[model samples]
Structures are given as C-alpha cells and as structure tokens.
Target: MLYIGIDLGTSAVKLLLMDETGRIHNVVSREYPLFFPHPGWSEQNPEDWFEQTLAGLEELVSGADRDKVAGISFGGQMHGLVILDENDAVIRPAILWNDGRTVKETDYLNQEIGRDRLSEYTANIAFAGFTAPKLLWVRDNEPENFARIRRIMLPKDYLCYRLSGTFATDLSDASGMLLLDVKNRRWSKEMLEICGVTEDQLPQLFESYEKVGTLKPELAKRLGLPEAVVIAAGAGDNAAAAVGTGTVGDGRCNISLGTSGTIFISSRQFRVDSNNALHSFDHADGTYHLMGCMLSAASCNKWWMDDILATKDYAGEQADITKLGENHVFFLPYLMGERSPWNDPMARATFTGITMDTTRADLTQAVLEGVCFATRDMYEIARSLGVHVDRTKICGGGAKSPLWRRMIANILNIKVDVPACEEGPGMGGAMLAMVADGVYATVEDAANAIVKVRETEEPDPELVAKYEERYRQFRTLYPALKPVFQEIAK
Candidate 1:
C-alpha cells in the first residue's frame, strides 16, 4: 500500500508519495504567495494554501496507483494563527510564524502576564511567533474579527480539517502555540484564559502518529483515493524533520536549515532551560525534546543572493566562499527578527566587521557562518544543560549546500550526518502515516527501519579552533547591538 506525505511550508506545499517500504515514487511542489502588508507583519491567505495543496496532491499521485494509497499525513509550518468563523470560513489571512507584529502582545505575555507563570502554564515564555500572542494581536486590533472566531488552528491543521473533516492537531505541532501545557500534553486553562480563548475554540489534540480520521469522501473520490484512507495527525516541521533524520531516542540531535533554522535534541526527559532559551516540547515519538529555532536561515542567503547580488546562481556564488573561518566579515542573521536564545523581535540583520578589503565571497561566507553561529548558540545552551551532543543529523534547504553543511559541522564542532532521503518533514509525515496504518508498531521502529545516513561531514580541529574564537567574538556583538536594537525599535 502507499502513503502520502504533505509538507505545508511557508512558500509552498510539497507532496510526496511512498510505498510501505519507504521508496519514494513521486513528489510535487506548488508555490503560493506570502504577503507582508506591514513592515514587521507576515501573512498568507489560507485559501491560497488550500488551492495549491490540493493541486499539488493531484499532481503528486497522478501516475501512481492511487487506489493503493492507504493513508495521508502532514508536516507543516507551525504556530500560524488560522481562525475560522461559525460557518467554517477562514476569518482572515493567517498570521505566520515569522510575523513580528505580535511584539506588543508578546511583551504583554512575558512582562505583564509574567514569563514564570506563562512558562508554568505552557512550558514556554512569550515569543512574537507563538499563537497566543497573535491571538492577542487580533483581539486588540481587530476585535470584531476576533469575536467571530469559532476555531483556532495551526497552518496544517487547517488543511487536515478541510481534507479530512476533522479539526485536530498533534502534540508536537501544538507545543509551539503557547496554548498547550506542553509538559502535560494538554490545553493550558490559564493560557486560554489569558488569551481570552476557550477550550471549544481549540482543535482536539492527538499524538503525531495517531489517526485523526479518514479523508473526506468527496475529496478522496475526486483525488482517486479510497474514502477509507487514513489521515494521521502529523508534527511541526522541525519535529517531523527530526523524525525523518532518525533523531529519535535520547540525546540524538538534528539541525534543520530551512527558511527557519533549528537545532533539535530529542530527550527522554522533560526539562526547560533555566533561561527559557530552548523550547521544551513533546516529541512525535511519545517522549519529549528541546528545540531552538531561528527565524531566518536559508532565507538570509536567499535574500543576499537574489535581492543583493541579483543572481540565481546560488552554487556559483558559494563556490568562491572557500576561506571558512579566517574572514573578518560577520553577519547577524536576524532579517525576520530572531528567536531561541534571543527572543528579540526588534533585532535587525547587520553586517559587522566588514572592511574595505572584504570581498563578495567574504560577505557570502559570513552569511553562512552567521547562520551556523546562531545555531551554535542553541547548541551551547543544550550543552550547558549537559545534553552532550557529539553528532547531529542535518536537513532542510541549507543542508543541501555542501558549504553550509561543512560550516555547521565545524562551527558546532560536531559530525553532521546527511540522510539518504533528505526530504525532511514530508518523508517523516509519510512515516507517521505508515504507523497510523499499522505498518509499524511505533515511530521509533519505523525510523530505525527507514532512515539512513547518506554521508557524514566531520569537523576539522583547526577549523573548530578558528570558529571557537570567531564564535566568542560573534557572541559579544549580539549583546552590544541588543541595546542598539531596542533603541532603534523605539
């Protein structure tokens, strides 16, 4: 039998088809527009995502034996605010995870509501990206629209509800919403009250591999699928990517370098950082994990290459960026503000230490190293907690770049393993569906059988020494600029 994995991303919906044995048969992607009506605001029409995802699914399974498709699952961009009216209509364009419009709301939660209480309720403090803050933004600014809300959901749950006739979300995805009692894997009543939301407004929670429902009969028929096809509640993008890379069990780590960068470490235990820098969330594999997310990763390079350099040749541009750690140029990857260690929405991207002799290659290398350094910030935090990671699985858009992969390996001073099937969340989505269909006993069992390392990038001692010093310097720059960032915001 076959399974379908749909990865609902920020820019596009990527669909994948695979048999029970994990061989990918076909893949399709459909792009949609991302809108920015205000400087710090990011939004996307839910209708646009729906249309593109449906079209992509049709194209994904076009040539395959659609009748054999047993299940469908999702891995999606997390923490987007998608609200529905009583009539089940999308109330507004979704406020995205990278949207920084919730700075005020986040402050209200962190300062007024108090981070200690918020963390006690949800196992996380306030961040501009979380759903709770976005809800406050809507309530304060668009009271009429907020009053009309009947249901609240993450980006992929909207798709799940539309396609499967079920309003549900999984633990891993819900963990980022700042609405879930993540340690307990349930809705936090205190958080709900604080956000002026009720339990009825939220979707039912499921384990990531659990079956939500079967596909809607009409959707299944139109798409040449059986009505009995299962719909499994999938995970947040990072968690799904972690599962895809086999970063399961205790102490395993994975780094995702997509539009957002993340360092994910799976832990059997539940523990939040003292500084609340890392996110403590339930994992898809029936355990707990910690994640540190950066708002911009590969997108930084994309902005530099496309907007600044005016070129489509990303590979050619990186080909000349050979001097890894000797460069005086430094870049702070905060284009969409920042998350993880620094929850500063006022932070702006900057190029520091650029001299008159700094060449284009130095600038490009700085962008790559900057992202790696930011990831290392998370790694160091995890180390401070005694997690002790010596190797990590790498995935996402930046993981495709050999230069970036090498830089991450050395910068973090850990071996980076590239998965044979580096499809990330999509592959993991399908694997979760397989578990839902009883093809596997557990998520870990499925992962152990399917995920394979294609190659490993090892760190060099000299390069590690060079980056150790550079990172020490890189760390100080953020602290110095933070006061400036706050001043500029004012």
Candidate 2:
C-alpha cells in the first residue's frame, strides 16, 4: 500500500508519497506567500494552504496506482491560530507561530496569570508564539473577530477539517496550543477557563496515527482518490520530525536545523525541567518528550550566504572553513530573537572577539559553531534533569553540510547519525499514515522497520576539548549582554 505525508510548512506545502516498505515514490512541493502586515506580525491565508496542498496532492499521486494509495496525513507548522466563524469560513489570515504581536498577551499570561500556575495547568509557560496568547491578542485587540470565533485550531488541523470534514487534532499538535494538559494528553479545564472558552470550542483530539475520518467523498473524487481514503490525525512538525528520525524510544534524540531549530529528546516518562528551559510535551508515539527550540537556525546561515554575501552556493562559502574550533570570533545566533533557554525576544545577533587576524572562514565557522553552542545550551539543561544523550539523529538543510554536521558532533561531543532518508516531518507523516492503515503495528515498529542510518559523525576528542572551552565562553556572553539588550530595546 502507499501512504501520503504532507508537511504544511511556513513557506511551502511539501507532499511525499511512500510505499508500505518506506521507499519514497515521489515528492512534490508548492510554495505559498507568507505575509507580514506589520513589522513583527506574520500571517497567511488558510485558504492558500488548502489550495496549495490539494494541488500538490494531485501532482503527488498522479503516476501512482490509484488502488495502492491508502491514507493521507500531515505534519504542520505548530501554534498558528486558525479561527472559523459560525459558517465555517476562515475569519482571518492565520496568525503564525513566529508572529510576535502577542508579546503583551504573553506577558499577561506569564506574569498576571502566573507562570507557576500556568505551568501546573498546561506543563508550559507563555511565549509570544503560543496559540493561547494569540487568542488573548485577538480578544483584546479585535473584539469583533474574537466574538465571531466559533472554532479554533492549529494550522494543519484546519486542512484536516477541509479534507475529511472533521474538526480534529492530534495530541502532539494540540500540545503546542498552551491549552493542553500535556502530561495527561487532554485539554486543561484551567486553561479553557483562562482562554474564556469551553471544550466545545476545541477540536476533537486523536493520537497522531489514528484515523480521524475518511476523505470527504466530493473532495476525494476531485483529487482522483478513493472516497474511502483515510485521513490520519498527524503530529506537530517537531514531533513528526522526531518520529521520522527514529527518535521514538527512550533516550533517543534528534536535532532539526531548519527555519527553527529544535533538540528533541524522547522518553517513556514525563518530566519537566525545573527552570522551564525545555518544553515538556507528549510525543506522537504515546510517550513524552522534552523539546528546546530556537527561533533561528539554518535561517542564520541563509541570511549570511544569501542576503549578506549575495551568493546562492552555500557549499562554496563553507569550502574554505577548514578551521573548526580555533576561531577567535564568536557569533550569537539570535537573528530572530531567541526561545528555549534564554526566552528573550530583545536579544540581538552579535559578532564578538573579532580581531585583525579574523578571516572570512573564521566568521563563517562562527555562524555554524554559534548554532551548535546554542543547541548545547539546551542539551545542558536536559542533562540537569538527568537526560543523558550519547548520540543524536540529525536532520534539516543544515545537516546536508558535512562541515556543519561535524561541527555539531564535535561541539556537542556526541555521535550524529545521518538517516538514509532525510525528508524529516514529511516522511514521518507518511509513516503515521501507514500506521493508521495497519501497515505497521505501532509507530515504534514502523520506525524500526523503516528508519535507517547510513553514516555517523563522531566527535574528535581534540576538537571536542577546544569546542568545550569555546562553549564555556559562549554561554557567558548571553547573560552578560542580557542587561545591555534590555537597555537598548528600552
């Protein structure tokens, strides 16, 4: 049987077709415009996502045997607020996960509502990107729209609704809404009260691999698909990416260096970091995981290579970066501000300790090293909670760079495994669909059968030692500059 996985990303909808044995048949991508109406606001038309995704799906399944295609699922950008009115029409362009207009609402939730109480209720505190804050922002600023909201959902759930005609979301995707009791995998009553909504306002929840409903007959017929094709409740992007990398069982870890970077550590037991440095959420595999995310990751490299250097050949720029840990210059990868350990929106990127001896190679090396160090900062906090990670599966565009892969391996001093298929969340979504169709017994069984590492990057002791010293200094700069960043923003 064949299954389809759709990655509903910030900039594009990526669709993949995979056989039951996990071999990819074809992949299709459709780009959509991302809107920035205000300086710090991000929005996108929900209709655009559905249109592009459907277009991509028609292209994805065109050449395949129609009878072989069994199921479809999604892995999507998390925490985007998608509201529908009584008529089930999209009320507005979705307020995206990266949008920062909710800073005031975030402050109210984290301060006036109290972080400890919020944490107790939902296993997380407020961030400007979380959906609950977006709801509060709507309630406070656009009262008419808020009053018109008859349904609320995450980005991909909106697509699932359109495809299957079911208002549904998976636990992993719902966990990011700041309204779920993540530990219990249910909606929190306290959070519902805080958001001024009831259970009726939320979508029905399902496990990531469970079949939500069959595709709507008319919609399926239009796409040349069987009306009986099942739609599985897919996961949040990070969780799906983790599953794609086989980071499902205990102690498994994966680092994604996409537009946003996340260090995901999967476990059987649920545990929250005392400092709240990492997000504790339910995994798609019916377990728990801790994730630390940074708003900017590979985007920093893209900025330097594309906008700053005016070059498209990323490999050509990195070809000369021979020196790894010895560079005197250090860069703070906070171009999009920061999340996870720091949680500071005012933090700005900085190039420190550059001397006359600094070369273009040195600066380039710093950018890669800076991201690795930032990832390690979260790794350190997970260690504090007794989460020991000896190795990690690596994915994303950054993982394509051999030098960056080695840098992450050495800087974190752990083995970095490159999977045979590096499609990330898109592949994972397909796997979830396969599970929903009974191609596999469970997510873990599907992972064990499909996921494979072709090679591994091992850290050099000498390089690790040098990078350890550099990381020590890198950790200090953020704290020392915290006060300066606040003053400048003021």
Candidate 3:
C-alpha cells in the first residue's frame, strides 16, 4: 500500500508519495502567496492552501498505483489562526505563525493576565505568534468577525477538515495554539474562557498517527484515491521534522533552519524551565519536547542577498566569508521580531560594528552567523535546564549550506548529523500515515526503520573556543539593544 504526506508550509504545499517501506516514490510542490498587510503582519488565504494542495496531491500520485494509496496525513506551519463562520466559510485571511501583529494582545496575556497563569494553563508563555493571543487580537480589533467565528482551526487542521471532512487536529500541532493544556493533552478551560471561546470552537484532538477519518469521498476520487483512504492527524512542522530525522525518545535533539529556525529537544517526560524560555509542547511521537523557535532564520539570509545585495548568487556572496568567528561585525536576526528565549516583538534586525573595512561578504557572514548565534542562545537555555545534548540532527533550507552547518556545529559545540533523506515534515507526515494504516506498529518503529543518518559534521575545538567568545558577545548585544528596541517600538 502507499501513503501520502502533505506538508502545508508557509510558502508552499509539499506533497510526497511513499510506500510502506518508506521509499519516496514521487514528490510535488505547489507555491502560494504570503501576505504582509503591515510591517510585522503575516497572513494567507485558506482557499489558497486547499487549491494548491488539491493540485499538488494530483501531481504527487499521478504515476503511482492509485488503488493502493491507503492513507494521507499532514505536517504544517503551527499557531496560525484560521477561523470559520457557521456555514464553514473562512472568516478572514489566516493569521500566520510568523505574524507579530498580536504584540498588544500578547502583552496582555503575558504581563496583564500574568505569565505564571499562562504557563500554568498552557505550559508556555504567550508569544506574539501564538493563536490565543491572535484570538484576543481579533476579538479586540475585529469584534464582528469574532462574533461570527463558529470554529477555530490551525493552518494544517483546516486542510485536515477540508480533505477528510473531520474537524480534527493532532496534539503536536494543537500544542502551539496556546490553548492546549500540553501536559494533560487537552484544551485548557482557563485559556478557552480567557479567549472567549468554547471547546466546540476547537477541533477534536488526536495523536499524530491516529486516523481521524477516511478522505472525503468526492475529494478522494478527484485525487484518484480510494474512498477507504485513511486520513491521519499529523504534526506541527518542527515536531514532524524531529520524527522525520528519528529524533524521538529521551533527550534527542534536531535543529531546523527553515524560514523559522528551531532547536527541538524531544523527551519522554514533561518539563518546563523556570523562565519558560523554551516551549514545552507535545511531540509528534505522543511524548513531549522542548522547542526554541526564532521568527527568522534562512529568511534573514534571503533578505540580505535578495533584497539588500540585489543579487541571486547566495553562494558567491558567502565564498569570501572565511573569517569564521574572528569577524568584528555582528547581526541581530530579529527581522520579524524574535521568539524562544527573548519573546520580544519589539526586537528588529540590525547590523552592528560595521566599519570602513567591512565588505559585503562581512555583512553576509554576519547575517548567517547571527542566526547561528541566536540558535545557540536557545541551546544555552536547554543546557541550563540540564538537557545535555552532545549531538543534533539538522534539516531545512539553511542546513544545505556547508558553511552554516560548520558554524552551527562549532557554535552549538555538537556533532551535526545530516539525515540520509531530509524531506522533513513531509516525510514524517507519510510515516505517520504509515502508522495510521497499520503499516507500522508505532511511530518510533516507523522512524527507526525509515530514518538514517547520512553524515556527521563534527565541531572543532579551536573553532568552538572562538565561537564561544563570539556567542558571549552576541548574548550581550540582545540585552543592550532590548531597551532601545522597546523605545523604537514606542
């Protein structure tokens, strides 16, 4: 039998076709537009996701044995607010996970409502991108739309509903909504009441590998799939990527350098740090994981190269950056504001310590190095929590850069393992589908069999020492500029 993995990303819907053996038969990607109405605001149309996904799924399974396609699942961007009216019509453009328009609402949740209360209810303090804060923003700003909202869903859960005719979301995805009582694997009553929402407004919760329902009959037929094709509730992108890299069990780590960067540490037990710097969310494997997410990662490099430098040659720009951690220039990668340890929406990207001698290469290197430095900031938090990580599995667009991987290795002072096949969330979604179809007994069993490490990038003691000093300097910049950032916002 065959399975399909649908990764509904911020920019595209990536569809993958796989067999029970985890062999990828075919893959297709369809791009969509991302909207920015305000400086830090991000949104997308729910209809766009469904339309492209429909096209991508058709192309993905085109040459495969259609009758043998047994299951379909998803891995998607988390925390996006996708509300629907009573007739199931989309209320507005989806407020995305990267959106920072909820700063006012986030402040109300964390400062006014109290971070301790939020942590007690949701195991996380409110970030500008979280759904609960977005809910409050809508209620405060768009009262009419808020009144019309009959259902609330995440970006991927909307796909789950459209495809399977089931209003369901996997626990891993729901954990980011800031509504789920993550440790208990249920919605928090306190959060629901605070957001002025009911339990009925949310989707039914399921484990990542659980079969929610069969695909909608007409839609299944349209995609050349059988009516019996099981639809499994999938995971959030980072958690799903962890599953794809086989980073499960206790104290396993994976670093993702996509549009947003994240250091995900999977654990068997539930634990939250004193400051709540890292998010304590349910994992795709039905356990729990601590994740630190940065709003900008690869996007910083993209912005520098495409928008600032006005060039398409990203590699050419990086070729001259051989100085490593010895550079005097530094960059703060807070273009869309920051998350994880900082959680400061007022933060903005900056290039500090540039002199007359600084070339384009120096600035370029700073952008890449800055992202690595920010990642290390999150790593330091996990270290403080006694989560010792000697090595990490790496994935995403930025991980393709040999220079960036070396930087991450030395900065984090850990061996970086590159997976044999790094399809990330898409692969994990298919693996979850395999489990839901009974192709595997469990997600771990599926991962152990399917995921393999191709290569390891080991850290150099000399480079690590140099980066240690660089990171120490990087840490101070955030604190010094934080007040300035707040003032700038005002």
Candidate 4:
C-alpha cells in the first residue's frame, strides 16, 4: 500500500508518497504566499493552504497506483491560529507561528498571569509565537472576529479538516498551543479560561499515528485517491522531523538546523526541567520529548551571505572557513529574537570580539559557531535534567553544510549521524500514515524498519575542548546584552 505525507510549511506545502517498504515514490511541492502586512507580523490565508495542498496532492499521485494508496497524513508548522465561523468559513487570515504581533499578549501571559502558573497549567510559558498568545491577541485586538470564532485550529489541523472533514489535532502539535495540559495529555481548562475560549472551540486531540477519519469521498476522488484511505493525525514540524530521523525511544536526539534550530531529545518518560528552559512536549512516537529552539540557524548564514556579502554561493563562501575552532570573532545568533533557554523576544543578534585581524573566514566561522553554541545551551539544560545524549541525528538545510555538521558534532561533542533521506517532517508524516494503516506496529517499529543512516560525523577531542571554551564565552554574551536588547526594543 502507499501512504501520503503532507508537510504544510510556512512557505509551501510539500507532499510525499511512499510505499509500505518506505521507498519514496514521488514528491511534489506547491508554493503559497506568506503575507507580511506590517513589520514583524506574518499572516497567511488558511484557504491558500488547502488550495495548494489539494493542487500538490494531484501532482504527487499523478502516476502512482491510485487504488493502492492507503492513507494520508500531515506534518505542519505549529502554533498558527486558524479560526472558523459557525458556517465553517475562515474568519480571518491565520496568525502564523513566526508572527511577532503577540508581544502584548505574551507579556500579559508571562508577566500578569505569571510564568509559574502557566508552566503548572500547560508545561510551557508564553512566547510571541505560541498559539495561546495569538488567540489572546485576536481577542484583544479584533474582538469582533473573536466573537465570530466557532472553532480554533492549528495550521495543519485546518488542512486535516479540509481533507477528512474532521476537526482534530495530535498531541505533538497541541502540546505547543499552551492550551494543552502537556504532562496530562489533555487540554488545560485554566488556560482555556485565560484565553477566553472554551474547550468546544478546540479540536479533538489524538496520538500522531491515530486514525482521525477516512478521507472525504468527494475530496479523495478529486485527488484520485480512494475514499477508504485513512487519515492519521500528524505532528508539529520538529516532532515529525524527529520521527523521520528515527529519533524515537529513550535518550534519542535529533538536531535540526533549518530557518530555526532545535535540539530534540526523546524519552519514554515525561520530564520537565525546573528552570523550564526546554519545552516539555508529547512526542509523535506516543511518549515524550524535550525540545530547545533557537529562532535563527541557517537564516543567519543566509543573512550573512545575501544581505551582508551580496552573494548567493553559500558553499563558495563557506569553503574558506578551514580553521575549525580557533576564530577570535564571536557571533550571537539572535537575528529573529530567540526562544528556548533565553525566551527573550527582545534579544538581538550581535558580532562581538571582532579585531582588525578578523578575516571574512573568521566572521563566517563565528556565525556558524554561534548557532552551534546556542544549540549547546539547550544541550546543557537537557543534561542538567539528567537526560544523557551521547549522539544525535542531524537534518534540515544547514545540516547540508559539512562544516556546520562538523561544528555541531564538535561543539556538542556528540556523534552526528546523517539520514540517507533528509525529508524530515514530510517523510515522518508518511511514516505516521503507514502506522495508522497498520503497515507497521508502532512508531518505533516503523522507524527502525525504514529510517536509514547515511554517515556519522565524529568529534575530535582537541576540537571539542576548543569549542567548550568558546561556548563558555558565547553563553555569557547573551546575558551581557540582555539589558541592551531590552533598551533598544523599548
């Protein structure tokens, strides 16, 4: 049988098809516009997602044995607020995960309501990117639209509803909403009340591999799919990427360096750090995982290459960065503020310790090292929680850079394995569909059976020692600049 995984991303919807044996049959991507009406504000028409997804699906299965298709699922951008009216029409443009318009709402949640209380209720604190804060933003800024809201949906759940005619979300995605009692695997009533929304507005939650519903007959037929195809509840992008990389089971780790960077550690047991530096969320594998996210990762390199150096040849630019861990210049990767340990939306990027001796290679090396150090900050927090990670799988766009991969392995002092196929969330989404269709017994089993490692990058002790010292200095810069960042934001 064949399964389809839809990755509803910020910029586009990528669709993948796979056989029961995990061979990718076909892949298709459809782009959609991301609107920025104001600086720091991101929005998208939810209907655009559905339209493009449908169009992508048509292309994804064009020549496949349509009758053999067994299931479809999704992995999507998390924390976007998608509202629907009583008639099931979209109420307004979706407030995206990257949207920064929720500063006031986030401040209210973290300050007025208290971070301790929020962590107790939802196992998370508010950030400008989280859905709960977006909900509050809508309620306060556009009360008329809030009054018309009949259902609240995450980005992918909106697509799931359009596909299956079922309003549902998975635990992995819901965990990020700040409306979920993550530790309990349920919705938090206190958070619901605080958001001024009811439980009825929320979608029914399911496990990532659980079957939500069969695809709608007419819609399935429209896409040349069988009506009996099972639709599984998929997960948040990082969780789905973890599943794809086979980072399931206890102590497994996956580091993603995309537009954002994340250090994800999977565990059989649920655990939260006392400091709450990492996000404690349910995993796509039906257990738990802790994730530390950095807003800027590969984008830092992009900004340097595009905006600063006026070049598009990233490889050519990185080619000169031969010296591994001895650059005197240091960079702080906070281009889009930051999340995870710092949780400071006011934080700004900085290039410190630059001397006249600093070459272009030294500055480029600093940018890469900065991201690795930020990831290490999360790694240290996870270790403090007694989560031992000896190695990790690496994926995403930045993982394509061998230099960055080596930097990560040395900085974190872990063996970094690269997957044969780095499709990430889209691949994981198809794997979940396979599980829902009984192609595999469990998520772990499916991952073990299908996910293949291509190569491993080992850290040299000398390099690791150098990076350790550099990381110590890198960690201090954030605190030193915190006051400055706050002042500038004001």
Model 3, span 32-151: residue lDDT tens: 999999888899999999999999988888898899999999899999999999999999999999998888899899899999999999999999999999999999999999999999
- Root-mean-square deviation of every model: 0.8, 0.9, 0.9, 1.1
Candidate 1 lDDT tens digits, 238-258: 888888889889999999999
lDDT of each: 0.93, 0.92, 0.93, 0.92
Give the per-residue lDDT of model 2 (tens digit) for 88-203. Answer: 99998999988878878888998999989989998999887889999999998999999999999999999999999999999988988999999989999999999887899899
Tens-digit lDDT string for candidate 4 (333-353): 998788888888788899999
Residue 106, candidate 3: alpha-carbon lDDT: 90
The parts of candidate 3 lying over 4 Å away from their true place are none
lDDT of 2: 0.92
Against the true structure, candidate 4 reaches a TM-score of 0.98
Clashing pairs in 3: none
TM-score, one value per model:
0.99, 0.99, 0.99, 0.98
| Model 1 root-mean-square deviation | 0.8
| TM value for model 1 | 0.99
Clashes in candidate 2: how many? Answer: 0
lDDT at position 320, candidate 4: 94
